[model samples]
Target: MKNFISVVVTLFAVSFAKAQIPAGYYDAATGLTGYSLKTKLKEIVTNGHQDKGYGGLWDAYKVGDLDKFYENDNTILDIYSEKPAGPDAYSYTPVTDQCGGTTPGSEGGCYNREHLFPQGFFSSASPMRNDYHHVMPTDNVVNGKRNNYPFGTVGTASWTSTNGSKLGVSSFPGFLGIVFEPIDEFKGDVARSLLYFITRYEDDLQTFNYSDVNNPQDGSKNRGFD
Candidate 1:
């Protein structure tokens, strides 16, 4: 939903790591396929869904968003600002660097919650608004620059962050809209997050507003996935 339509297609990258899904999570959908499998998954995934509210995300990030892989410095591992090959241009301590509303004038200012699926489409509704799976801590300026654009393959970048994430016109076929392209290392994270959003919120997908995307007409059933 949420102008995230293009992401459903651009999600070919392999996840950097895979978590162990709950033991019986997909057992119900085992023999299903196509829409049937999708329906079963909707039931399977949404069964125990809970909303921790918006405040809980900060606490969740403390466990889920820390830097343990690359620099191993225990700073915030921001996908939009992380430079894996060498040192990061800047880094944030978990709580100390969390931003309020004001964004820094530069790239490495402060980190804030970035909704991969965006909150605007659903009017910032519950569960979806606070879904820790899709809401991630990212640099304030880069997050602002991403500004709800659908993730896609960029042909020509209008702007690029220090880590090479881009805000650009789509190079992907069948779409010419503006898109934000995250770096290769994090593309799978973006893809998986968006897919989780779709599955988790399948019932509400039809109602999300996609008018903000380039071709408002594609906001309906197919959700700009043409």
Candidate 2:
């Protein structure tokens, strides 16, 4: 029964025609290194990545939110959950396809797209706002709590998600400010998405409003803001 249940849930998720990078998409990136390799890789992703309109994400989430263990019904497939295998972060009974709700009172209210790097940081411009790599499934209330804050280690908790995620001052190196802190399990996933943003947009990164990148802020065409 357990295996049967997992199969059913996974099928539900896979039923969506999930967008994906094309085969041989990275062929051009082969044998490349550092700046040159990264540049080609950027071209590959930027050119191949289909820009699913911002509104097309409801379908996307259904496909992506399948990792939650079947045993944990309605529990978020949250990286912040200390008990990712079972038991919910909070009292959640997932409302089917009920993502991006206008107002969620708490954890289980609904899920929404969480911009790991934050779209506002880039001024909510095109492509960047709709990039699926940066946009991910998250509990509605928890997503709201994250707001537009950057992610980093938290020292004092201003607030805590039912799953135990927290928002507070930064303890990460080279910066000090309010930051969202997810569980350790999700750190690598978040880091990769952020790196993807830098790599894929390397050609136009400097144009974005944020100064986190090491590029010149001259607003050049290759400014990396796209």
Candidate 3:
């Protein structure tokens, strides 16, 4: 069943290879690739993106994943609970303390609205803070462990998710700092997500504090996967 699900997901991605944008969306950037192609996509997507509010994400982000989320399991495709590691998955119940934890910032106190991109680097600016594209649902404890660390291979795990997502130093060359490494099963999903954030926010990146395509914290480039 897991293999079947994986195949289905792969097919879904393959289908996207032939994706079409609305009429004339990239007519100007036809045949463009690399930086130029990305530039055009940035203009196209940014132009159409709606700056939704932070409050709206709870209701909004769960659109496609609600059914997939096992409420009793206390997760939303949680990497910490997948397997080969998961035993004590942090729950995602939202009724008690929303906006995540305010203190003791190392464990899951409430459902966490994680920024795929660190908010501190961006100074919690609007659109980025409110943008659902970059933020995601995670446990407050797991989220805190991830903190502002960049994603990379964890050679020596100081912390680990039940499913094997890790928080530690970067063993994956190019980037050699503390970083978060989601489990293998979710690596592709994470990559796709971060890429979308970069592509969608390319233009506005110049105004932000850190805009490096790789290692946004230090402007050092690194491979997306280990």
Which candidate has the top score in TM-score?
A: 1
lDDT of 1 by residue, 75-156 (tens): 9999999988988899999999999777589987889999988788788998799999899999999999998788888998
lDDT of 2 by residue, 1-226 (tens): 3342333223323432255645765577666544565566567667757888887666665556555454445343555543554566443334463564368675666667787767766788878888877787777677888887777799989998765689998887766678888877677667667656766667656666656442213354332321
Q: Candidate 2 has which clashing residue pairs, if any? A: 204-223, 204-224, 204-225, 205-223, 205-224, 206-223, 207-223
| lDDT winner, 1 or 3 | 1
Would you estimate the TM-scores of all the predictions?
0.86, 0.73, 0.72
lDDT of each: 0.78, 0.63, 0.61
Q: Cα deviation in Å at residue 212, candidate 3?
A: 11
Taking all chains together, the TM-score of candidate 2 against the true structure is 0.73
Candidate 2: which stretches are off by over 4 Å?
A: 1-24, 68-76, 80-82, 90-97, 211-226
Candidate 1 residue 98 C-alpha distance from true site, Å = 0.2
Those runs of model 1 whose alpha carbons end farther than 4 Å from true positions after fitting are 1-19, 214-226
Candidate 2: minimum summed lDDT over ten consecutive residues — where?
8-17
lDDT (10s digit) by residue, model 3, range 1-226: 3342334334334434557545765576566554555556557667867876878777764553332433334344445444533334454444444453365454445555788777776678888888876677766677878888787788999888666788888898776778898888767766666666666665555555664343353332221111
